[model samples]
Target: MCSLAPHPFLSLSKPFTKRTLISLRNVIRDSALNKPGILADSSASPSRDAAVLIPFCNVNDVPGILFEVRGKTLRSHSGEISFPGGRIDSTDKSFLAGALRETREELGISPNRVEVLGELGPTEVNLRGNMRVWPYVAFVHGHQINEKGTLDTPLSSIDLEDVWKHRSLEEVASVFHLPLQALASPVRLKASKFRGGWPYWAVDVSDLVEAEKVEHGDGEFVDEVGCGQEGRIEIWGLTGWYLSLLTRILQIHS
Candidate 1:
């Protein structure tokens, strides 16, 4: 299990001040307003459509973002840290519903507990350049944190130890929270380049006990390739791209 610790510089005692929430809402609104125009060109006739929820929660009053480590046995994106979501199902009424449904299936979090803030726009993932991902900003309500600054013992009505014991084990290995303040901090973000000279951003997670070395698709481990804290547990690819957009919004609003 990964240790859930606040960044050294963040004071958990005072997390989401009124001003912070206001700023966050403002950012979400601005993104929603500007998304359509920004994505109109690239999003046309996308090969695939999917949605992901960027869930914000106040744990011990500290604002953090929820992420799931995909189960190793999964066929796609195994052992990767990602936002809770998946491809749109035929029965899904809307992208929002699909995102929420996937969240519930992956993390056992009820959609009622998530307060949708707004959409952050659609973006194309680098994986084969075929998938389009619509991201939604949301706040998770009623979930509490313990004195240790971790999720309350029985998260989403089940004990922490039993998180992987559920049927979601086929998709999710474990769930974890990363402090939004830490991600928004300049010191924690590093600038890098991706294939074809594309600009990329990554968060430093070297201090995290859960950070592990990433293995390539060929079953070979690359020591210094992917983006992550010190090249380990790379948060690169589409996940890194989405988080980069989030950190940018936070920086502007901060």
Candidate 2:
């Protein structure tokens, strides 16, 4: 059974207090961070495992985030958009450890190079009617990678110049709002099902969620809800929920 405890996510309406922001600054100052050896198993019923890294790099004087489109060849969550992390391995001492490990494996991110900024609460899921999931968050410094001396490398060597570009938090927020407003719109609720099943929704302007059909200018397709705006960041599913909360907190502080 799932726990009744509520998870805490970052809000966008208000910026963090000076003290809180300072705390985050302090976390980034840490001298050493450990790495997890490998990722964990995803088999069995309601098991606890999985960690994801919200990797960020400073490019052209702005923070740019790294996300992945899982290769369609994968067995689970194929071709979905997500962070560079995965399931907790037996070697992982903790959830944070697992997250860093998976990120390193998938995106060639080094655990030691990433400074932890704390984690958001976990999200639970039953994959394929089995495999329980727990998702956690961590912030990383935005810096560039040197080909020879850099701390990481691309696992797939696939081109990411288009999606992995520098985007201001404000731009990200504007894109986010386009969907939050829609979620409140009656049109969305009519399509949303009960909690017993899946949470289906989309944001046309920045439809990040996978369930919702992101309009790609080819004329809207059926069963696919147009994400109002064209070519905007699509926010949906777990990533959408996480972004929504993060934006709320950042906005509150800013």
Tell me how far the alpha carbon of residue 109 in candidate 1 is from the true structure, in angstroms, after superposition: 0.2
lDDT of each: 0.62, 0.41
Worst-scoring 10-residue span by lDDT in model 1? 145-154
**Cα deviation of 165, candidate 2, in Å:** 14
lDDT of 2 at 174: 16
Give one digit per residue, the lDDT tens place, for model 1 in 1-254: 11134323333334543344445667767754336656423545567778999887666555677777777787878877788999988999998999999988987877877767777754655466666788888776554322222322212322334333543977876666676656655565567654445565766654442543568899987432223554565456677767666655554212
TM-score of candidate 2 on Cα atoms, chains taken together: 0.50
What TM-score would each prediction reach against the true structure?
A: 0.72, 0.50
Error of 2 at 248 (Å): 2.3
